[model samples]
Target: MRHLIRRVALAAALLAPAMPALAQETLRLRMNGDVNTLDPISTTNFTVRNAAYLMFDTLYAMDETYQPQPQMAEGTEISEDGLTYTITLRDGLMFHDGSPVTAADAVASLERWGSVDGLGQTLFSKMESIEATDDRTLVIQLAEPWGLVLDALGKISSNVPVIMPAEQAATPASEAVQEPIGSGPYRLVPEEWVPGSVVVFEKFEDYVPRDEPPSMAAGGKIAHFDRVEAIYIPDTATAINALIAGEIDWIEEVPADMLRYFDGVDTAEAVAARQSGNSMQLVVNHLNPPFDDPLVRQALQLAVSQDDFLLAAYGDGEDRYLKCAAVFFCNGPYATDVNTDRVLERDPEAAQALLDEAGYDGTPVMLMHVSDIPTHDAYYAVLKPMLEEAGFTVEVQPSDWATVATRRASKEPVADGGWNVFFTGWGFVDQSNPMTNVYVSGACDDAWFGWACSDELQQLREDFAVAETEEERMALAEEMQRLTHDLVSYVPLGQAFPSVGIATDLEGYIESPVPFFWNLQRVE
Candidate 1:
């Protein structure tokens, strides 16, 4: 009888419903690439911006319409002269450590970012200084009237200003890397960051939602996830398998060809739409030979068939290429109706004629590529054959993204005495304001092609910078675009549609031009 009872108890235990693990409540999102650093000032890469969004809040956030909305600041006022601005802070706001966030902290954070030698300082160089008038208010004095200040504050690159604690800023740089403190919705869980594998964040219970409610703020919703676990899944195929097997909740960059595989899965749904702030193009090192010749650059530009590349990289009929009047602002101002088909169509004969005219006698050209970027690899593959067919001796050189970025930053010559041609990509500035991000004389240093800075371009940039009215700014921007189009610094190829995969039951999973994980909320 005791043996019988024991058997019955064991059977009951086996039949009992499986209870969820205590940690299952946390949302885990597998990202395509690893972040270089959590520091906002380090680089302007999207991976860094996505990570920072969870841990930091900017002064002004962007709304669905891409308008600026106040966040930590309760309200702001622009001076009549348009040179000075005053920002009022919200009351009862506190950092993760329960210390009150003050105007002093805001000032210090801006100053720290402005003083740093990286991209943020480059963007915010317009600011003369930020002064704290009181515990609740901060005043920003600009070198000149910048109409795009509000717009700049909402951009993914330099816009999301991560406010660091005063005490933490005072701490030495060596110690600061290990110690990160912020007032965002999530706090860093030091133990969960397993070096190269994953970084986890636990939601801060004390995180105060923006005071005037969601309607008043940009980016309509506050962070809703209780916990966010960002696992670094480097391999594309492994990430797809993990998603299909339900090992991870979501994947950021779903490979273009793998879209159909997820269609039949009942629990998983795919979200693919036109992604904003991204562009793929070929960059020529103007200082280098062959490309240094305008005719050669134009010839190369004419040889590329954007349609073929778009289909291959983004799947057949799944992508679109934009035609802008100026190379600088592809989608914005002074974009008048003109025939771009002549320039973008694959014309090998025309390309060869131009090359011959420029005295190119079959000299070898090096094409630099970052190996990890699948899209870039795909673009390079297409371009190589085209160039070779046009009677140019082309060599393709591949390196890791970091190495490529370092090389580009250092302006070093490519292997075999430097690259004459290379393919690269960039994120879009907010609402097609191309002047600030991609325009030759704008924030982008060294102009991508290592071209000598033109005085004419510099003057044009200055005019756009201080243009009082929208009409004036647009005109200047148009002229700048005309210059870039004529010069062909970098040939504009195409834009990408970000593919996202999410679980079916997940609600509030709206698609954005910029792929951000913050919008996921479970309704079911």
Candidate 2:
């Protein structure tokens, strides 16, 4: 049996073509959407951020255990008063344009990022100055003691801190960079970029990998394939078929309903992509009349049914989803249900009574429906009925994800092309702590979309940052969670465990909060 199996394998190898293999080894991957922009700091879109990970490196990165680890930095020093942080860059760091990665570039990039990001804004508020002392050393001098300095520098999710040349980093945060230049493991092939079709990248042969092994977003990022293509396929069935036919190496967003199709396929495997999964949410515009009322927001929260939303996206199976009422994820460090009983109740009568008490006069709440992304569309499809059942009027304005992304930024009235609410998702890492979560930011006009501003909530978050012990931090976190639910900062609909379809011949895929393409190699 062994001799016959060996003979068959040898015959198949000899029959295969060698021209394509020798010309250029390409790894094709299918993402749910396209990389519309190259500026990592300007937008919070996951697709663009994921693509940027391949071409950019950060000062620090979060490990699998969710702790900050140095990535581009060699070491750091602190003052006795804890108000100064001195970071030194590693040796042999070179950008794609053949320029040395210097402290001036790091300072410029961080300054630009701090102008837009929620956490970066808060960090810079207390910072006296962040200046480059030498070519390889940067110093951050704080006006007071802020405990989340490292956490702000090592943020792993959207709005990642990607170091670039000083000239490129000098651009304003409101504008997007037309072309991106980085010092990561891959270099983007500008000539092969197609707007909605495919984005290509070639491995940077000059990149120097770290000595440590691969972790979540830390350690060495080894590019095993010579070329990589991120192909966009909006249709689920077509992408799945391509994976099964060996036309693509992986699919980022695999629908739960299509899990049965891969049951008999021996070459493809569909599995959970992350350990903690993602949390779905409904963000309401607090600048408008209907949602501007706290009672109205709380009433809408009462009408939400986590199970229904999870069922619509991940089906009825509990294996793919779970009910989590905490503002932070259910199983995370600061998970608490201090004031989430009303949300878990899913009571329509209680919600209707609250709406009546608030004198809601049947105003049409405009719900922005994203047509392209299936998961976000499913959320709105289930959300509209839930709000209506509790005595509120709903108008679902249907558009693609990009249109909704642009429309959500408008603060005008709903009658004037503005929006009342929209739905989106965030990874477990983004919701792990009070300071890191964008939803928890209460900086008034400077906050994330929906703009839930409250001085009390903001103070509580600042207190959480400076808390000296775990008990003190936990207490503050509980207070913040209670206040968040009471204020209805955002509606939390359970968690969804997204799955990915990958060919069995590929290996070294990292299990992270988001999909990464480093250390992945194709088997011969």
Candidate 3:
């Protein structure tokens, strides 16, 4: 049995090609969605985030144990009272553009990121000021002591705290950035980019990997290939075929339906190399009608079924899917069933009563459905009529995941290109901790997509941050979960654990929650 990474992953069944082994130089792989916005702070999609992980470096990164490890920072100095933190940049750090990374660059990067990412907003609320005290040093004066500051800085999720050149990082969070500059081992090759087809990257010769061995998103981010090309192959058959024919070296994700195609294929080996992860969320825009009424939100929550969604998405099985009953995650360390009693019960009659009581006047729910992910189809198929049965009019809007990423940002009314509901997922890593969870932040307009806000949610998160003991934190987590149910933050459909196919000849693939490109090398 091969050593697989992460807590749980799909038995990707093993992967690679039938072609003769060759030295790894330029690795070729493909994925489902197109990289939306390279501007790290502007978007939150798996495609863009995975690419950003390659092109950019952060102040801190997560090790295998999920602890914060210094990436570009020499070390962090905190005042005893925890009211102040001074971070000094690692010496000789240089961006892909050959510009020296300075303390000012990191300050601006954090500022811009805070304007968008949910965790960043939390940090901003506690921050009195964050400025460069010297070329190599950043001094953070907090309004109060916060324990998750480093965790926020080291957030490994999308809208990640990817440090950039001060000028580039200065781009307004509302606007998409044109440049993709960073200090990571791989430099994104812009000219080779094709809008929806291919993205090319070349290794940076000047990159300085840390001395320690690579682990998770930290340590030495040694790039073993001279070039890496990610070709968007939305069709699983095409992607798998490419892998089998040696036309492609790896496929980031192999859809559940395609797993059968790999059975007994000598050259193909799919491994469940990561954890059983990601939740399909039925997001209702709180900024608009229907969803604005907690009663209506509760109605929708009652009508839908997680089992129906999961069966359609991953097929009926315990291995392919997990019955997640909580807003955080189903079975993880901090998973709780705070307010999921109603959610777990599929009651159309009760949902109708709630909607009728809310005076919902048949307002059309602009359900923005994603066409990319194979499982998303199951989401739309399961949700449309259930909402209609519960006294809500459903308008199905169709598009790729990239379009969903942009349109979800709209705060407009449903009639004016705004969205009422949509489908998306988050790695459990983004949720387990109350303070780190993006969906539960309740930062109002600054919240992820739907812009859900609640005073109770915010207060709970703040308290969760300062919590010192495991018992206390877990108790707070339950309260936060309870609050999440009350606010109807977002309806979590279920957990879908998919696997990826990689070349059996390749080595140094680290098992992580997300797609990682560093530390891989080709061998015969």
Per-residue alpha-carbon lDDT of candidate 2 for residues 24-48, written as tens digits (9 for 90 to 100): 2777777767666677897887778
Total backbone collisions, model 3: 10
Candidate with best lDDT = 2
Please give, for residues 327-381, the per-residue lDDT of candidate 3 as tens digits.
Answer: 6777777887777887788899999999889998988887777776677766887
Worst 10 residues of 3 by lDDT: 5-14
Cα lDDT of model 1 by residue, 1-524, tens digit: 43443333223222323312643455667654554456654444456556766777667776666677787778889999887889998766677777888888887776665554223444466778778999889998888777767655554554356676776655432122454677877877665565345667777887777644343125434567777777665555555565565556777766577777786787676776554436666766776677778798788877878777777677663543453323543555544333355356778998899999999977678776555556666777788898888778887777645445435544455553455666655655432554444435522344433453456766786666667787887777667656665566677776665577776666655545545555466655
The lDDT of each candidate is: 0.62, 0.83, 0.79
Per-model RMSD to reference? 7.5, 5.7, 5.6
Off by over 4 Å in 2: 1-24, 415-417
